[model samples]
Target: MRFGGFKRLRRFSTSRRLWVALVLLALLAAVLLLQQRSEPPDEDSGNGYAGLGEDAMEYAQAEPSHSLQFPGDHGPHPDYRIEWWYLTANLEDENGEPLGIQWTLFRQALASPDDEDDDSDSPWSTDQLWMAHAALSTPQDHWFDERFARGRPGPDQQGQAGVTTEPFSAWLDDWQLMSRDRDSGDLDSLSVTARGIDDDNTFGYRLDLTAEGPLVLHGVDGFSQKTADGQGSFYYSQPFYRVEGQVEIDGEMRNVSGRAWLDREWSSQIMGPAQQGWDWFSLHLADGYKLMAFRLRGGGEDGGDYLSGSWISPDGNVTNLDDDAIELIPTEHSEIEDREIPTQWRLRLPGQDLDVTVKARHPDRWLDTVFPYWEGDVTVEGSHSGIGFLEMTGY
Candidate 1:
């Protein structure tokens, strides 16, 4: 079945503009708000997390030879089935209390552009669905919220949810991550703000991010291979963001400063049906080094786990590592919300003489959104020292 309340919204576009906007919001609320606390799909249910493993043969594929460009690539790729602009930060308040923040805007095509109806000229004609998630995590609690909207890009319309690249702005309602410099390119400087409510406590942040190094590309220039069958995505990141800002939790605001990371990736098909979920990490080491790595369970050569990563130097140089070069082992687990999640991990990169234990600062950093997952701040120790973020999906 289609969205519950959207079929009736198309007829109201010719009415007053204010009424049209309200109807659009009401439609989104009907579709998503009810699913806020739903359970995640079963392990053997859909393809993968949020059906990301579903086949998309009709849409544009992320080819290895397809080179990625700046400024233009910063905007939405409507021809693709899925894309996201994700940012995560590790911050410390004035009192040295550590906290974490995550802001993400995701875009999914309801139908391929080739399949769009030629007669669909109304501003309400939508072929794209947008969702945003914002969260803040403290030592004892995690606050998170989700928002949804519907839009389609065309000459005559700027939908309620969309992104533009000239100055780099992404938003769904009041929550936004925008470029500070109006003439900025390559997303070197940015400011992000969002407010979310958890139970009765409200939380959010406003931060300015400045790049200290260059943007790093993963896999072959930007085509990150995801499976043994050659499925992958166009992936790159600005992991050098130096952040200065303030965060508010439960009406209490505190000055904070630390590092942040922004990840940009788009793909038609990122995983095969055999792949369940993934465990990913992005770490900023103490002695001026960074590492990005992930393990895709059941997507490897013989139905094992697929592993790949990038070992980045201080100056933003990247050394891509294949499965044989990197190792990840879960040494501890945390039982929370009726699930056992691995909260501590032992990561070893033999090629770089690097071995580190990555442990979550707290085990309560579970995001209870439409698509649930575990994400939180992590500490790096053993042959290295620093902090970063960890994300785990599919249990």
Candidate 2:
């Protein structure tokens, strides 16, 4: 969607453009923070939030060396520059109508761990920025919204946005995803709530998710690789969730139930200089297996793509997948929000005896947020039948 006709729209303020950038690259918002530390107030650096130049040594980076710990790792890792708690549900309404929902909270540190103790007289000073995004898609229509906030990092959590490991809560304003059991680790049982407003009306959801299987870590025990040179993030997922909740849209509330996938990852930098974007997939097969795969465009082995994933058995055994084990190819395209997007894809895992074609229920599932992208529930056909979510970025 393009803004036109209004002269004021032609000269969107710097803050407005920043908000657009914040939504488009929410996970990489720390780049803006780093620039703020180096630039003057009146001057604007259009470099945006990405790329690690001189600051490479100033912050932490993901490696095959660091091991991920639960509960603590599930919370915030402020030492790293970027992290996000992402959730996507493949659900159905009481009438058996298909519905896809999403709720996410992103945290990007303005300062490295060493800068956390910087002298500041004001109690409201903060070194952390928070952002949230939520969306809902039915068979015929899609609704989405974005939010932003500022707060102090750890040891100071009395702000508008923060996460706690004890009760395990990640939130911004009234929107949050919290643990139902304080004593439970790995966030076994949890509740999620997020609300957003668009032109159509208000749409949001409150859902309960219970894990039926153990967590599946990506790459080498949660140390996911993004490029051949070893730049990546710590990635893992609770893909065996049995979700039951209520969805409220257009002032009407209805019950919903289905499967949900929870992703927790953090990194100083997930993209290299030549990388454009990525295509991520999370599918639940009919035979009780789960598949998580992604292709990092332009930032892979020998400047191609860093393709990798994880194959999770029904009993929770994980088989780490690299470029050799899987194949991801764009099969079809659709023009949405002025960009040609691959709404249909073909994925294969020869060892698992799985060869499937994934298709979006509708092409209109384009999320016209700060940076528009395609994220919607997908149906699998070919060797097996099931439902899942497909995310394609960098159009």
Candidate 3:
């Protein structure tokens, strides 16, 4: 009789596992179907909102002067329209060859948490959407891929793609970035891993990042103003990570060590109606200084360009920069896929007496994702010499 009871228990466990697997498969299919029905904004239309500027009166707005708390704010803000965990690295292989990497996880709310009905308890019900992007760039080759998933609400049901704050983990499928010390919840030290295939070329990385400096807040107390009308985001960064790891490209692996920057921002309206897109830069100067700057195509005073940045000293002190304090100019352009992209730029910050040319290492670093853009490693020259990353959108 005891043997029979054990056999019954074993069968029950197997059946439960099978049922859970089937449920997950169904959830994934539903997410993909819904994602396909949704359309991205037309890039050529000069859409200022990136399809995110729509009225979100029901969702939470990123108000100024609200304090940002750690470990808690590190996780998802489902009440907002959009949020992202963005990380970029500039590394050199064992042979001293340069490589670039970008990993991002973005979360968008399908509906307000308050709108969740009785079906919210169902395993298939989800009001959150998660998307992730992974890319690896070589001197001549760039590989990129993206993934999407649905997020389950509640602490016990994390679904396929979600972020947890207690131990600091953010994942989609197998790609993950989490705290190195599972017992700690801080973002100072992390381990990241991701792999993807593009056009017969396989690429990925497994890196360990250790923060060397304190976190830096941008704009006014971590409230970054995006437009002249007080619209913006809660932005901050850990710009002093020392990274060492292995990166694989085209099935070839190499050991690498370098610097990385991680950015955290969330907002309901990151751009105004007239603002098209932006050109953003994160530079690591050779002299132990760092600069974060951006130029918005429109929505400034009198519908002009809006500019903002933060000049960081080696110790992580931040000096917020205004539009008049910095200058950004496109010096050269590259015609890629029939689009004229500014592959080279001249950046000037008068307050720090810094004048530098920031140019993309290679122009083919375009990410042809659902919302295509150019993002890759850049070399800084002129007054300051160093390496960093640049992201340009809206052509």
Candidate 4:
């Protein structure tokens, strides 16, 4: 569930949800542009609005000045056409074996908000389509699954899937990420549960998460610009959760405890066609500092590249970084699932005197999801050593 450059945790919902939304929007663009309202715009020749292209005027766009309100904003923003809630964690078993977990819920508005109000005549009427993906990873193996459904916004709405911030819950089928403390406005404490089966095995997790720090806003108070062209998303993260619970794989339960990261982002146009894909990183350093960074390929002048990141101090101060402030270079690649992927990376933050090599825990952490991508636990070595997660997409 990585949106190419978004590199999940905060990116899974963005990437996975946007994948479906863009595919659907692309189909719409194909039909509308081929019809050529006024002889097809040069930017949109019906190739689908991969990044909304020149036909983005039809849907609501994510502008920088938009305020992200409290719990309400934690739920669905159906007006935007696409949104997601993504959760990722780095857990350790009783024996101290590293584990990785992910759960994501994506909402793709089948029709614009204005249309949903008039188009749905019944609770079953489909205005918003939802998709979810869940996965669990051991040091040597990975398992995952995906599900889909249709929904409409209303108090009467009920299904295997939905999101409500009142009590703060996001779910699809039996997989859920919800709040444990209802009276609180912030997501201070929460519980996550999910069970999935992929052809040969059954996997799931039941975990308790408690926030140890405040929410970290990414890119100028949640407006994370993706490309140099300024297309981006409303992104924020609670990357300081302490987790404890049980993870079940193949029906075997293992008690686990570790740290987790929760990312919330929503946007209409998160990328442009020129921006091919991305390599994203979320590192939880041993000293309490956190880093979220990415490399968006091909959005520069003449289709070059763009880079950016956020540095969070132990006390929760965020230092927004531009392309020049940080460097993320792929140091090695591996052939996995028949795709060439960067299995290792060299991250350098000179100002902080931080230089490290982050490598995947294993190469086979390939999620055979609707939009398949690589997601796994990573080990950081060099200036500051720790563990984190890596999400690479579009390759």
Candidate 5:
């Protein structure tokens, strides 16, 4: 969900990590062996071999030119290479103390783009893998956790990841985003819960989310183009969730409520070969509008990374923006996880006559996990006042 660290890997021995990694590799090898064994003797050449490589490239290059569909589109798109359901909340306890929570599920495809013959016989044959991250940050301390699982296509599997409309449940394993309604399926009242343990620290939460505003899609018609060549992902958000729930830390339950934002994005090829990482922002303004922005950091000769975002009005009107239409300037940097991260930022949108300053709620909110980075709550002001989350990866 949130790609941030390699810290956890240190706890395991080289032999143990290798053993686990080998198990996964062996599973993949077995699947490949089975596919080769099942191929018909003379039916191979006509099965689009010459076109396979080209088809894969074409699939990667095809313009994400279509508009996004809701309800139906919110479900999984196994055809894509990567996808994520990211949620962040800025909350206050019953005592009005500030707190933050994050839960995210990331999906990555292991097979090539053209490998689409449904290998449904074996549950382990799926080329998709799922990973999730959960975190809670208070003024005094920060706690985070992560999970990984192989994606299975059936209900028999415990670590399943999918979305449904009628009951409005979207989840991966015990970590979920589901409707609180006992009858109808709507985005009104929802529940989110995640649990995990690391070393001697154990953390998790069960919270209720009530939507105070409508869902908003980013970019034109939901096709969020990321690169100059028009490579992009479909993105959307629910930025006005009033949260009232409880978090369990070290077996202690604390009642809390705050604002939350939910982000859903899917793509076939997210990072190009030359892109190292990305920095993303999702802000909920005090006056009602929401802001979402991101910049992909291209490595080597790929030039500066691509940047884009959306300006959503209070009533749900979206103003899609391009790189030239907006600006994000890093003013200060701090060493986080052995990397320099800009904790202070200046944002300007000329067309909207807006300029704002952004800062992290705290510097220690850095999640030191499998894929680590800075993903914490932040405050924004100047032209607008807001509270939201700021994420920096591959720093």
Candidate 6:
């Protein structure tokens, strides 16, 4: 992700006020988990595309998805309301000291707020936008970055977001995840480069990643339902990356090598109005299995949040997790950026008879950038002693 500074004026204008109003409205709309509240008289309440009424009629009303094709699957699904390519890594330098890294690109379709049919201009005119965040952390310090862009659909103009297979490149300008060969679509030899400049500092990185394991998909046939009513998304991951790269802190280059995980998911409507944020984890277990889990936390007790995960066996078999199957409880909270974040967690998997305690490798891994959050390297003990990445967003 890239971070840039725009020139600022001392005065406010009518247009600025309107922009502020739009942002507030969007935030309010997100907080209204539609599941628990009664729909308006004119609204459609079914789980199918028909329930979305004429607004989103173009989307197919098919049953939960099952088949997923690769190469093509790595690209965008514009019809979806949201999509992202998230990567995290747990690594150690030559000294064996631990370090962690994260890079993610998020796409949010602004036009389909409630799946209502609202005809605007060109499909490119649709209000879709993109945002990205990247971070790096060591026991002694933490570094973070954030970037935002507008989305376009066609090739003449670089869509603010895209993923290509021919040369195996995926990126959104200066900030990108691309193949080094520029000819081979092999991801094992690809390079991930991202740069960001902020008032406090300027940071960037370019890393070479080689896959150590196979790619894993979550849920049944690629459709991962996140809510009780079957609201869900398509999700998959590549979690066995052996990375050797360099990160530029301020103006110095530091060589680093580590393990990395990449996650990609897309959905037309994933979260209900009540859902506010999420706590996500990607652990690289010492026992050979990798664990990926997330909890969608809705507001208050009246509405229920959702949880799902994948348990990757050493040999690369992926087991999908149901809502009732996984649990992550906050054992302690630390104040960062004037916000309380759970720094320690108790993770439980009932069916596998697994229970583990995870603690931050250090508490200061919090990224204090736009869309600030705590996403850093962590260590898991109890049932298994291993290293992993923890990501807590929206809170």
- Kindly give the stretch of ten consecutive residues in candidate 5 with the minimal lDDT sum: 46-55
lDDT digits (tens) for residues 1-395 of candidate 1: 00111212212223334544644564465335323434554567456665577676467999899998988888889889889999999998988999899999988776666764434667566667787889888888788876777766463225667889888899988889999999875688999999876676789899999999999999999999999999999999999999999999888889999999999989877777777788999999998899999998878998799999999999999999999999999999999778899999999998898999999999888776556788899999998999999988877
lDDT: the better of candidates 3 and 6: 3
lDDT of 4 at 3: 30
Per-residue lDDT, model 3, residue 306, is 95
Error of 4 at 1 (Å): 6.4
Q: What are the lDDT figures for the candidates, one per model? A: 0.82, 0.78, 0.82, 0.78, 0.72, 0.68
Worst 10 residues of 3 by lDDT: 1-10
Model 6 alpha-carbon miss at residue 261, Å: 0.2
Screening candidate 3 with a backbone cut-off below 3 angstroms (N, C-alpha, C), the clashing residue pairs are none
Q: TM-score, each model?
A: 0.88, 0.87, 0.87, 0.87, 0.83, 0.79
Cα RMSD (angstroms) for every candidate in the order listed: 6.5, 5.4, 9.7, 5.4, 6.8, 6.5
- lDDT (Cα, 0-100) at 26 in candidate 1: 44
What is candidate 6's lDDT per residue for 197-297, written digit by digit as tens? 54466677888888877888787777776666666678888888889988877897787887888887886655544455678889988888899898877
Q: How many collisions per candidate?
A: 0, 2, 0, 5, 7, 6
Instruction: Please list the residue runs of candidate 3 whose C-alpha ends up more than 4 Å from where it truly belongs after superposition.
Output: 1-49, 116-118, 155-157
- lDDT of model 6, residue 231: 63
Model 6: worst 10 consecutive residues (lDDT sum):
46-55
Error of 2 at 333 (Å): 0.5
Residue pairs clashing in model 4 are: 1-12, 3-15, 8-12, 26-48, 160-173
Error of 1 at 97 (Å): 1.0
Worst 10 residues of 2 by lDDT: 1-10
Model 6, backbone clash pairs (residues 3+ apart or across chains), number: 6
lDDT of 4 by residue, 276-373 (tens): 56778889999999999988776765666788889999889999988887888888999987789999999999988999999999988877565567
